[model samples]
Target: MEGKEQNRQEGIPLQFCKNKTKRRDKSFNVYIKTFGCQMNKYDSEILEGLLKTRGFTLTPHIEYADIALFNTCSVREHAERRVYGQVNMLSPQICSLGKSKRGDNYPNKRIIGVIGCMAQAHKEKIFDRLPQVDLVCGPQNLYNIPDYLEDIAKNNKRILAVDRRERPVDRENFSFRNKRRYLTAYVTIMEGCNNFCSYCIVPFVRGREVSRPPSLIIKEIEVLIKKGAKEVTLLGQNVNSYGRDFNNGYNFIQLLKDIDKMHELRRLRFITSHPKDASDEMFIAMSKLPTVCESLHLPIQSGSDKILKSMNRKYTREDYLRKVDILRKLIPEVSLTTDIIVGFPNETDEDFAETIDIMKRVQFDTAYIFKYSPRPYTQAARLEDNVPKKVKEERHQELLRLQKNITLSNNKKLINRKVGVLVESADEKGDYLIGRSRTDKVVIFKGPKELIGKIVEVRIIDASLANLKGEWIRL
Candidate 1:
């Protein structure tokens, strides 16, 4: 036990299999194709870290990989369809990979695993549909992937692990810190959601809300900052409801306050706040904390009170507006972004008009407009998808047009203004550095390549619906 602890403290990763042969220690490349939100991206990072513990190397090229994993999302029908399409296209290529010198399939055959929410949703059905898949592990059982691969390598049987009872909280030790892009990191403070919004499949697939210990979260952020992370975004299905599961009085506001005390952390952010849980104290924390950005991503799925109630949102249109009013009053320069769903079941022309009215009233900086699609096992799926397809398309387009105009107008207002942008990355051509302002607006500017991870003031020279072009002004 002393030796093992010393090895861990020395940064020497122990293999999952202790009695492994010398052949297993050789580096085997893994390619992960992630299709989903930020949470899924973070999950892929964890998956990569776990695979590394088993002596596996990450490869960017799919053709050279010994194993291929798809971290999927089941949020909408469109997202699922995309995963299927990509899997089919890569099937033959994945199968042809990892041909050993001896030409034996055992221990050397290229492995394909379907992990994450989609794996939980469909389970072993993916194996029946896609015979190429060797493993199907869900979000809850992600920690078992490395062990499952070991078993498959020894014995050629396919593995299916979708257990929901176990919470892999200890997986925090394997948070994959990206050395190349240390400007920002995602720290998932909690997992799962109790609020089963009628249109959402999150609660069903992810299970109930389970918040991580605040001590673990703080330690993770400290490590990230020490490793050159300038910013960290606290992630959860609904971030504002962070510590309700705990007996302690530690809530989202307190969590923010504690994280703000980290002097090395330059910026802080969070996402997907539910309107019902958005509180004055949370807004106040955002205003008081110098590290916290003046931006909020409160998702308002619909503007009509009728649709909101039907979707089990638990917040009326007026309630949402009231919260928005409070937020604006507290953080006058807050950049509000949101998610809007159009053409929900039985939605009338009036209901969609109400959505338009809310958009006009709020003038959000950006809105992710998604057409309503019934997810499997969701309450919305049980109802007759009454809205016509053509009408849904029309309304989706109308919302996009309106939001595009509003976003352009908002950007135009920033012209000639100087904003501090945390440089995130460079354009592919290396002609410009791309970064985001405190408001979370993307700003592209010409600067020294050394400015990749530092915050610099950029003067806004041009504006567009997508991004703002700026000139680096060393003030």
Candidate 2:
């Protein structure tokens, strides 16, 4: 541990402090703009928590911030492009601020940084792309942000802290700065990915899988519940493989069971379960755990066996179907959602048809469909992107159209049925409240503002492809 700390310190060099006398007495405010995934959002919360402890305040407005950070994603090309655009928009303003006169209200040296997957994936290249950025740190190095900022403030130096070493999860660093707007919160039980799915950049950027101790996870959720968080979603690249790195016999199922025993937690959820790791014991736990939500987001990138093989997903279509069948048998009310990629490299017409056929058979409650975009450092990137752009768009549209009808039909089945919804917030018009059912369906109904953090019963009156319209039955 001592050697590791020494090496970490050596990796991030501290230059001679020149502007130490110019340090201000005022508390610095940080503005974090997050993009992509629940994991990134949770990361931002941790960032704010750490900054707050170092006498920095969290500000929602970018213009009022002394430090502007972009917590970015590298999942898709568009996500990376969007972050670049955001950096472009903020760079000139930040540069202009640095050139302006120093005053009591305005600091002459405002720092800009990029943190998260994009920072890890791109590394030093981000400096070339966004010349005004003072820091580029990865997910693993986020805990060091306070130190990096302090160095920048004292020495006026650029810092890049993208350490890929396997670090143990620090439970204390996972704290949130303030109470959440809603009752639901996301708790990342594990970090990184071991599965090198051909289309995924997670393994490359997030490093290997490491699960937090089960006791730590339970303790975090318990604390959140005490702070009025009623719903918690466990996040991971592949949540089903959570305890594979440990030898104490605790796994994802046991973790869920432990969390389920928390009396104050109304809902327990998890995401991105691999079909190959969907064990029968897990299904049994889901069935028996009272607080566990009856919803699963199992991603089957492609329904075609050939494409699945090429993607190295390790599960056959039959294997996926069997798991789904088992889940449905155990929990009849379970809502199933999946992810689909339209144009993987060398995907044939029959492969595309198989995806559509599986969609028809499963009638997924919802599906996140995407046109394939090859990511750097992935196996798929080396393969020719054979599918034409026009063809990819057509396939994408076809799947969307098919799923729209299926979702509408599935939602229509709930018409006039009573369901319990955990009200989250008021809708835009303020005439109604919006909440989510246990199955994760968005339901809107007329209610008072007091219903925001409470669960109430509602009768489904109408349905659309995306949401359910309901009448409030009672709180």
Candidate 3:
């Protein structure tokens, strides 16, 4: 997977189907399973759009589908393990034995594919491990999926397309699949990362930073807004590094200001801001923009300057603290969230203590703590994984317990306060509506189904570590 191969294997050019605008077909169903983060979810939507244009239906059940695609993540060893487990389970059930729904019996099997980051990272290794897979496509080469499927059906041969090319995105049609549209949408403003954090594999799989043209993004958001989408989250690896690839002075702040001017847009959000790129202008835009949500996800992988330096994070503990201060000062009621890695190579007790101390000071509303897993071809992988499993588990539990208390304390402060929530869905019993506040906290309250896509006011009455119970108020 690490070694580069020809852009296409076995003379398969990266291309889309000629008849992409054909009417949708009800027979062929594509069941997709997505793992990892919001970026993968957005990528799945892109796949849905591409398949839909070629007349395939999206199905929730895997039993009835003619094709199955696994959109994978390679961020953590746990994620990779889960994908392998699922694929292994699927091999005996659907590979080589099952017949296609079309009853052609030429191939005599359902088409199985491995796509996204994992496919890009592992390449032909997947074929060696899982012989039942018919197609493998990387994130950048998604547009070639339909054509590859056709070739597999015709030639009965395996196809692998993990070429690192500057592929163009079909923004006009592929922004969000029409069949599975949601009120809250995710639009990618940029792709890939430039920061090669020592412990991360994103740069290897996703390539360098490339910003989508501002006009295309604005156009896509306008379309989503017209389709009754009330909220939009811009997806990226590190959103703070958005426009660095461009020579023009236009950057992330300007992008937000332009998008904020849309009168119909109710709320806007973004994720995974790098601490090194945190800027005063960006915070100011978030503070003043009416449509931008007050929630921010800034990842500070470590608080120990020593560990931080080894991770190639480029920012120190003091630098992170200052950024947090600026954000709090600009948006006093802002909800802060972060990512923390507990076990790194050669982490000492003092390093772990620094992480605990910073968590206490920041009091993040939420934190995603992960036990470090050494990935192949990474700098950290070369170091001795000195921390034992028992110690890592202990540190991980300690962080979780501390964060639980902090989250409960923060939620308690919201009691008796009015917050605006965009109603997203309802519980199975239909007795309660679930939505998120501007601060990105889940708030559930009794409401009519008619209020699903609207932003309504809710007064917090009870608080919990997971969510808040609120009383509905008129918009």
Candidate 4:
């Protein structure tokens, strides 16, 4: 939208996703089309958090919104395709928004632009397909959002704000409410990855790991809590590798210790840990921190040492096993979760067997198994996409089948245990509510609406592959 329409408007544009009463008619409402991981979700939330300060409200549906943003992910191939599809789906809205105000367009034209990884990878190419896209921003270019929006308001031309390199700071300090209603939130402590794992493009696409100063992260977490956040998961491509980019002594463990001291935080967690950086000190810190959740999402992409080396995962099977042993020994009751990339080029059945072996051995409480999708411009793409599609599917199904058994077995063990559950919302019948334990297991039980915002104890009566049935116990 142009500066003129923005200036002439009596009230903000239409808000499809925002709470109407709180939104000004003169402001714009934005719906984010996020396609990626928890980190992308966090980044989108941060963008909305900033937008809230500028009198913008967030919408849940994109088709009818005043502004549309696509938070893209490039971890796998299909993920990027999905982002493009989202942009195409919104084309009519973009054109209509553009057509309505052509002579004196509000110019926000709903300002459809792509951001995050896809924007980081495809950059200007996105515009070639969707020229109506007013601004294209990347994960690291988050701070430039306001400026890009401002530039579009004036010039009415497309602007792209994407950079793979880490830019130290860009948080505009907006409170993200509804994190459980605003419950669990992922807080990005650092941006980008330094590890150029042969199978990954994160390093080239996201640039090197640049840790947000510990103080900046702490301040961000404080704001999230004030807005009613109960839990936070510190985010980075490699969380344990945080602070290595600097000479400062503050590391991931130190950050955890500091955040753990926050009086308002009920639980804390982190993810996408690299086995290479899963340092001893971090494990000790996790065991000691009272508020730290008894769970970790360390991704073991492959279990065969040969595949590990081929993937350039840095750590071998023995190394990863040692780290797992350390975590188990130190945090005895810690619930373990992981990511498994099922098929890589040249993965033999024996290699596949090794991964299955680890699944049985770790008995991971949860596993997100996926067949590998070759992403463009990654080192892995340089190699032949040798794993047959059928084989990849079979490997993926086999892993899931194994994980289902593992999860059910672990959940069965939780039966009869009274655990702390942070009540999220009422069940469909209004007869029950749902929440997660510190271990991040989903638990369901009968409860009053009043229990929605508080953590309560629930006695487990039954279990399932994906969730648990429980009875809320009055404290």
Give per-candidate clash totals.
0, 0, 0, 19
lDDT of 2 at 172: 53
lDDT of 1: 0.83
Q: RMSD in Å for candidate 4, one decimal?
A: 5.3
User: Model 3 residue 85 lDDT?
Assistant: 85
What is every candidate's alpha-carbon RMSD to the true fold?
7.0, 4.8, 5.0, 5.3
Reference-based lDDT, each prediction: 0.83, 0.83, 0.84, 0.77
> Could you arrange the candidates by TM-score from highest to lowest?
3, 1, 2, 4
lDDT digits (tens) for residues 1-475 of candidate 2: 1111112133333222123233244667688999999999988888888788788877888866668999999989989999999878873243223222233332355678889999999887887787767788888888778888777665556777787875535535445434455389888888889889999999988999989888878888877887789899999988999898898787898888888888889999999798889888889999999999999998888889999999999999999999989999999989999999999999999999999989998889999999999999999999999999999999999999999999999999999989999999997889999999999999999989998899899999999988999999853
Model 1 residue runs over 4 Å out of place are 1-26, 92-109, 168-170, 174-179
Among these predictions, the greatest lDDT belongs to 3
- Between candidates 2 and 3, name the one with more favorable lDDT: 3
**TM of each candidate vs. truth:** 0.92, 0.91, 0.92, 0.88
Evaluate residue 328 in candidate 3 and report its C-alpha lDDT on the 0 to 100 scale.
97
Q: How many clashes does the backbone of model 3 have? A: 0
lDDT of 4 by residue, 40-112 (tens): 8877766776777667667787755667888888888888778777677664333223322233433324667
lDDT of 2 at 329: 98
Pairs clashing in candidate 2?
none
Which 10 consecutive positions of candidate 2 have the poorest summed lDDT?
1-10
